[model samples]
Target chain A: MERWIISFCIIAIEVWGAVYFFDIFMERKRKGWLDKGRYMILYLATVLVALLDMYQDTMVIKVLVAVLELMAFCAVFYKAELKQCIFFSMLNYSLLFLTDIFSLLIENILNSKDELYALENPFWLVPMKMVRVFLLIVLRWIWKGKNSYGALSYKEWRKFGMVPVFTFVSMLVMYFCYSGEKKVQAAYLFLSAGLIAMNFLVMVLMQDILEKGELLRESALTDQKKESQLSHYRDMQALYERQGRKMHDYKNQIRTIQVLLKEGDTQAAAGLAERLTESIFVEMSAVNTNHAVVNAVLNQKFHVARGQGISMIFRVGDMSGMRLDGEETVILLSNLLDNAIHECVKVAGLGRKAVINIKLVEEGGKLIFSVKNPVAKKVQVADSIVLDSGGGMHGVGLMNVKAVVDKYGGDFAISCDQEKFQAVVML
Target chain B: MKIAICDDREDDRGALKALLEAYGQDFEIREYGSGESLCKDMDYIRECGIVFLDINMDGMDGLEVARQIKSECPKVHIVLVTAYVNYALDGYKVKASRFLLKDDLEQTLQECMDDILREILQEERVMEFGFVEGNVRLKVDDIIYIETNKHKNVFYTQEQTFNIYKKMDELEEDLKEMGFVRIHQSFLINMKYIERISSYVMVLTTGKEISVPKSRYSEVKRQYTLFKGVE
Candidate 1:
């Protein structure tokens, strides 16, 4: 009865260490006593299987049942996807296997013979189990709050899962082939260390892949937004052309009225003049500049700003000397105005009338563009570029603007205070 | 100040003259019926501070007349007036300071005159300081930046640097309205000369780079952007 009780205590410690190890990377699904109760059930089942294996001497059945119980425990108590649960379960079980192998290797080095005899002796078994559990807890503490793998998708989890799965199978095979020979024991310790190193390498690689993927996705979204903005500007240009034709017709009608008044029909001439004036529709494309692209982009941004209840004031000088192509003009102006509008909307939300001031001028053979808007939060700028604090797509948009400015061998500067932010580009 | 209006139509010239008179500034106004007649008097063109030109003149069109005037007097502020919007692009080729549509001259004329007057004031404004060598007069627009070093303020321009015994705080107050910005404790820079800012460093058009402190970087950048927009 004493021996059975000792086995139960050792098994409880091992299961508890494994549960905490998996908890390092996985988030809990629910909180409170219900979650604790689920963990208790998992602990009890794992200990029961381990105790049964000790008496029955079936190592394969014991590891299989323990792995399934851990996986089921993760699915029930954690908020991870299926692949993530499976991957972490395999990783946890492999670490437990490694700790046991490490303790056995140490025992062999200390005794040099009678390894099976040591396994049956309570004095040896109790110390070995304590060492195994201590190693597990130490590892869990070192990786206490790290969740580097949390950002990855299920596909990535599946791909990276292979490493732990391979190590676990190899460990199982090594356990089955173990003979009390000194050569095999030495090989087992070296192989276990190699497997642990491999798992660490996989973690580093996963983090690198996550960062690169985020940047790639951001740039793709920026390009897509640019394309849509360009198309919308093109559509606005077509509308302006139609308006131009309508204005020409209105002019002809006015001339006809002038001729009618010259004749004896005064009432008809008055009626026609009044009707013509009433039919003339005034639209938002009132901005007229020397550059067609500038006019289009400004009008579109003006419409957007007005829709959001933000006022935009433009002081545009002659832009004929700007020397930029249509696409470059759209990219530069649209990005600047879009960012300004975004800041203005935030300011408007705070019960203040939001206003954006934009200026585009050609001075001394260079095109200067600037935008100023009120800011609700303090902005951070480094090396003259505004740093994105929220990790959003705003940073990517500014990067595109900077890229265009660099192409022209120009200058870009951003400045902000507690209540306002401004961006300026000279090309 | 001398203001000149050149147009082929008599009524159009009268319309511009009436608007100029309503501007409430004391000016000696001269009228030319054609572009050739305006270009004939070189002495009058040289002394004029601002010249208004009509683009669709009868002979030696406004653009050619503008090019000739710019070649002779590069400091003259040329205001180009046109009936159609297409001529504005051609006006830019001659380096016109402002563009006005004849259809809405009443609304745009006041703003144009305000800008031209402010620019002329900036061009004529000069400051005198007691330098270590002697007292020197310098154009406010020509100053690129000022660095405070060893209890002396050094003013850097395109041609030379002048050292004067003045505090930076006093100089910043005097030059703030004239497009100067205090980017650092030791540096007071002219916004017009700023080429770019990168990595906490402000690069001037004269190929000089000044490092900005991390604490003051954001405010400096914000002030620079606002200065560019206002200018």
Candidate 2:
């Protein structure tokens, strides 16, 4: 009855911890924090731990709680922040190791191994065996989680750093506690079962995540291709229609001026002509071109550049209607134009000039598309289009052009002299 | 001789018409706006000695209008008028009689009208890059062919003259705007330079030739565009 009451007290404390965990987690959530729910579950699992202690001489529940606790620690940090997480994990492990050594020293100094064992000592072998089982589950749990999740979170991996330390200390304590006449056999079967399950779970999750990532990348490529194709046809029709409308407006301006002149109002005719000409100059080439993707891309980039007061000259001289298909033309021109416009607009406040020049010419059987822009800022290029000073997204347009050029067996190169950034594509 | 000017911008069209009227003594001028308007019930191209066209008109680019006018009546001269300098090349490829830049429209219009009169008198001379003996000179006209070997660039003229190279770039640089291309690494040949350009070699009009590099031959042909492309 005394044992049952003590067990009830332990279970009650564990249940309270389990319930309070939700409040801790939910409060954090309201402040925008993440919890993997492992902690609350492990605390509740401690109730099972107490009940298991009452029934079996085995340390299964203690080991299982350690396993779950280690997992809670791992989920605390994101995957791939490996070096930092591992460094802190080792620091915690060292502290546990020192405590373990100190505990062994005290046990040896007391010199009371046998009597302590039979007296239901805290360092006794049943608990020692339970601690050992717990650590095994902990190690396996951390390893399984780390490999699958791209390393355990800071907390969990740190718990792992404590593993060898906890083992050393627990082993010393076990030596002290199991020095009596009877020594309980360890639960070897559960250790094997636990690690096996963890390994299997890790394999399945890793495979699932990788496969999903691959599928997502391919889907994005196909979606971009379809959008580009549609943009091509749409661009041609829009350019044709806009220029058509502009011509009609031009004709009316002349007729209106002519009518005013015929009425002998010479001043009105001249005034009307001046207004029409001013409007024409300002709205010139706002009309879309023959390739939709290129048109949309250039129009957006042009607006972005114009707003910044960077002078831009984007003109297609002659494709000869045979140099490139609509799709290739759009991809090449859009990427080139976007990069030139972007760099041109980024420079600020200098007698320093900001200008973007793009020219396409057919020479020696190659279609040469050149983009040159001036920047006050220096650009540093790394492997894979990384700019030292900006987000990786700055190079995506160039990469898009590179991908197409490589597909077509063309040459693309970037060179800079003075403030000029030049990218040349030859196909 | 009669001439026509068509454009969507009234000022551009009117200014060009006035400039031509001031200089064109023997030419009668007709004006139209929009390609569709010109295409409907107008034989202005057939009656005119030349037509001044604008590429940015509302319904048709000056290029398309040139193409249609030439298709209908190839003998009519075409002078493309545009405020933008970029469209000048399209005028030539479309077989325009001349490209008139509006920034210098007054001077260019008179020169263009004079060229039309010269073409009528059968005394017109196109631009050319030439080499005479040791010196590379660009003849304004009368160049028959140009050839280059490993050591020297050569130019042949209408008088059967041969000029050798001082610098390959002299021809390319002096006549770069006049349409001389670097067709081969060893040879910067003019369009008037080649009698026949094949997969293997470029035969010059002077009976001298340069072998086209295997890598750059196709590119040379594509840029020169003496023949229609597969596409």
DockQ of each: 0.06, 0.03
Top model by DockQ, which number?
1
Which stretches of model 1 miss by more than 4 angstroms?
Answer: A1-328, A334-367, A370-423, B133-136, B157-161, B194-231
- Candidate 1 RMSD computed on C-alpha atoms after optimal superposition onto the true structure: 15.9
Q: What are the per-residue Cα lDDT tens digits for candidate 2 across A3-76?
A: 55555554454334333322221222211133455445544555565555567654444444444443344334
Which stretch of 10 consecutive residues in model 1 chain B shows the poorest summed lDDT? B83-92
TM-score, every prediction: 0.49, 0.36
TM-score of chain A, all candidates: 0.56, 0.43
Best by lDDT: 1
Docking class of 2: incorrect
- lDDT of candidate 1 over B68-117, digit per residue (tens): 99999999989888664445456667878766767557755775687679
Q: lDDT for each of the candidates?
A: 0.76, 0.53
Residues B144-188 of candidate 2 have per-residue lDDT tens digits of 545566577655566665656457666567655343557665566
Alpha-carbon DockQ of candidate 2: 0.03
